[model samples]
Target: MNLEVLSQHMNLISLVVLAVVVAIGFIKKINIGFFSIGAAFILGLAGQMSAKDISKGFSSSMFVTLVGVTFFFGMASQNGTLDLFSKKIVALVGKRTYLIPILMFALSAFISAIGPGHIAAGILMTTFAVYLAFELDINPMATALYAKLGANAGCASTLSMTGILAKNLSEPLGYTGFGTHLFLTTLLSGFVFTLILYIYYKGYKVKGDNPLKLSDIPAFNRDQKITVAAIVIMVVACIGFKLDTGLFAFVAAAVLILLGCADEKKAIKSIPWGTLMLICGVGVLVNVIDKLGGITLVSDFLSSHMNQSTAAPIMAATSGILSWVSSTTGVVMPTLYPICDNIVKTFGSNVSYVELISAVTATSFAAAISPLSTGGAIIMSSYSAAKETTTDEMNKMFKTLFLLSVMNVVINVIMAALGVFNLGHLFY
Candidate 1:
């Protein structure tokens, strides 16, 4: 075959194999990364690529960033620091159970924005929020959803894991200085949906909790104090001075371990190794696909179906659908972000790349509440742990959570359509 024909064949081969890999991930028993590596090898062979060509797709930078940040926060999470901090925040509303949901939203947002980002915050906050739901006699799902939303809202900050990853993915695509813009848009979108959830769950009616005394809550111990300080410093360093996030996290985590405040083994184990692997592995596949023209296909498909006015929201809607079964940071962002440049080209000069970026990001995270996603899975497991449940109840909860996820995604898409995500245009 000629070079052009071989290139087309390689693109088709990589795209089809990627589809199979992603479908296999949905099987629940398989990790997609393994298949992705093998698929990349196949593409490498087909395209006359060297082994280095296949392996180069592995993003060591992204891996280190994910590992360092998660390990650092993992130490804090395992040390009871975050838990105690959560309780202290919950104590703010005192018997005003109606306000607990909003409080949880803000608490999660603050925790996430400060450093750990949504993945860590969602796991920690969703569990806490669900427990509070039962304790405060409120809607468990609603509370969990609010906390999840809050986690997502604050996760896009420059200091946080997702924010860093978003920048890493977007910057190479020529979308520089959009991190702060993306952060603001995601934060605002998060609050808008959180308020919708609060009203829907009737936050004004949540009652029947006795006051939690501030004195009854223990003050931060030395280790917890150190950990909190490290987080704050990391935030300032990354945002104000523009230090590397992953390296700073490693320094903070090492200090915590050296001080005997956090267990090294436990913290290491707490990191989501599987998720990290999936991220890097799928990145390999996506990189290969991009090299082979799969991204061109995506751009063509989008251009065929969408216009300038609808382009941003269309991307939002597509991202929302894919995010139900994919990682927003890992799979969705890396794979789809490259299409932004092409999107701008196809839709017209007036298309705001920042808005498109914001819409896709905000909408993808909107679907994080799906039971298939980590946030929803945590809510499910935490609820089951705290209460006696039957199979039917679990099934119902899953469906209800999925529906709520749809609601959240729909709101994000509508906001994107209405130019709400255009808020980022100011900063851009």
Candidate 2:
């Protein structure tokens, strides 16, 4: 075979191997990261990638971010600070138990909008939201969904990773005002989804016979007090001052350890190392795929199939589907947005650059709720950590989250097809 044909075949085989890894993980209930790392080694060797090149695929930044954030929060949980804060929030809501989910949703969105990204926000919010739900006899599944959706809502802000990526990708194509338009689209869709979840979950019917009194809530202990202050500082430093969140979290966690607020061994064990491995291992494999031209192959397929009338929905669906097992920000957006620019060039006025990018942005983020994605993984971990949730219950929750992600993709696809929330014209 010629070099070109060999390259294409290599890319195709690598993709198939990736799908198999995902399937094996799902079926065997194993950590997919181990499978992914194995696949990367095999594929990298087959594709003639050097050892150094293969090592570059591991996303150290992402690994540190996941470890640091989870460790910091784990310390908080161990110190009883998360419980104390949950009680205060619950007490503040009083007898109106229906507002709990909504509050969690809004708080998640606000947290992401300011900084910390969707997965970080989901980790922080879902942990507390699930705990609160269990305590209040609320639907933990509904609360978890709302919290994740809220993170999606605000993850398109200018300061967010998704927003920065979208801007960088679209700006070279003469697309301005991408951040505002994408943020608004995400916000509107998130609000609608939250509303539906609230009504369907019968949140309106939730009422407590006796409201929690502020006076009855126990005062914070010395450890909890220090931990809370550290958390606040971490947020301010990361969000307000634009510090590296993971590094800041690590420093804060170290301080907590030194202060005797958290058990060092337990805190170390609390980090979600499986999730980090899954993400980083997949990152390495995806880098191999890119090097083997898999991304180009997918982009070429999309370019060939796209036309004026079908472009919006096709692009949105393509992004959502691929992002199910990949990083939307790191892989999907970077690969697909350039293809969008190509489409705009090829079709001219027939394809709206703004609408296309907006659809891609919205749909890509909507799929972050998938169980395979980081945000969804965090939610699953949070639910799993709860003493009240059983193994069977966690399995059911996974199915629920997967279905929710599918529904989210369908909704965004429909919205894009119907031009429901396309704010691209404003940018024009």
Candidate 3:
């Protein structure tokens, strides 16, 4: 780890800078993307890569995807469609306030499973769930946590975002036919986490007078109806036809605006520009890390310490830790899928590859609620947008999320060790 050794090992150097970037960004309140981009440049140059080659790390596709989906959902939020729609759903349970959290959890899972993916579902639903927490006298922390958990849970279907990514990655590594089991692992493990959140928040004992009544509430107006239709079309396209979610969303949003159904200014403003920069910027550094073999180094480091009994849990733990600061879909899966091959080779063929893959996907997503990740960011940003929050409050929430995320990862780790995720026989 000396300077000369680090200079020759650009991957180690990049990882050192990545660790530093996270530290400085957290302590100084600076966007990590700024530091990530700078690190990319330095690392790329030191590796003899040109500036243009380094700039290629910028993920333009992800940028457009976020912008388009957010713009569409932003319009939905601004037009009161989100509020009214969520209220209508809440009204279904009447005064049984206890069902509120459960309903939101189920709804979040279903929405994410349908195909918009966790990012789109988590952003839109976590925002609405927070708003509902305020509207209905429920705990915002529990509400947002359920939303994030549910989104992550159902997003592992082969038809969905993370699930599709898992398939593509695993297929090449000869871990085919893992989609169904991976989905089941995430869904069941996610429910376990949701149950814990429910108990901790006393969801069953929740009592509140819901002011909304289905009988009294008016139906959607002409404009709202149009917005609803637009949304339905986007959902149908994404699910039924397997269209590009962001592109379809943009098209749907544009049609709604053309029909005079949404406020152009407010819809534009509702897009989370800062969050976009954070994800895409860190994404640049992630690209650099991938190209420089930093992710591979970390994966190798973890694999070097495994044995027959310890392999599954250790792999799960490693994926969880890496996912705290990285994208589970974009980075973790691609790096770890191949490592499963190595694990099997070293430890004999008795190791369940499906179990290992499940451990990776399940535990990595368990850490998604950390403040450094998108789902947790939505919770904080949505909270601030809903009310006047102090910097101290934000910091406190950040710490709280990290703790909750650790608890979640621990739950999955125990499950991994218990062989709960071992569904290999069903498929293989």
The root-mean-square deviation over C-alpha atoms between each candidate and the true structure, in angstroms, is 1.9, 5.1, 4.6
lDDT at 45 for candidate 2?
88
Candidate 1 lDDT over 36-121, as tens digits, reads 88888887778777888778888798789889998999999999999998888778767677778788888999999877789889
Off by over 4 Å in 1: 1-7
Cα lDDT tens digits for candidate 3, 112-213: 775556886788788888887888877887888888899999888754667656664565457776767888899998899999889988999988877678
Off by more than 4 A, model 3: 1-7, 111-144, 151-184, 200-202, 322-361, 368-403, 419-428
Q: What is the lDDT of candidate 1?
A: 0.84
Error of 3 at 211 (Å): 2.2
Stretches off by above 4 angstroms in model 2 are 1-8, 108-144, 151-188, 307-312, 322-405, 418-428
How many steric clashes between backbone atoms does each model show?
0, 0, 0
Query: Can you give the lDDT of residue 123 in candidate 3?
Result: 81
Model 2, residue 294: C-alpha shift (Å): 1.1
Q: In model 1, what is the error at residue 225, expressed in angstroms?
A: 1.2
lDDT of each structure?
Answer: 0.84, 0.75, 0.78
Query: Which of the numbered candidates is closest to the native, going by highest lDDT?
Result: 1
Ranking by lDDT: 1, 3, 2
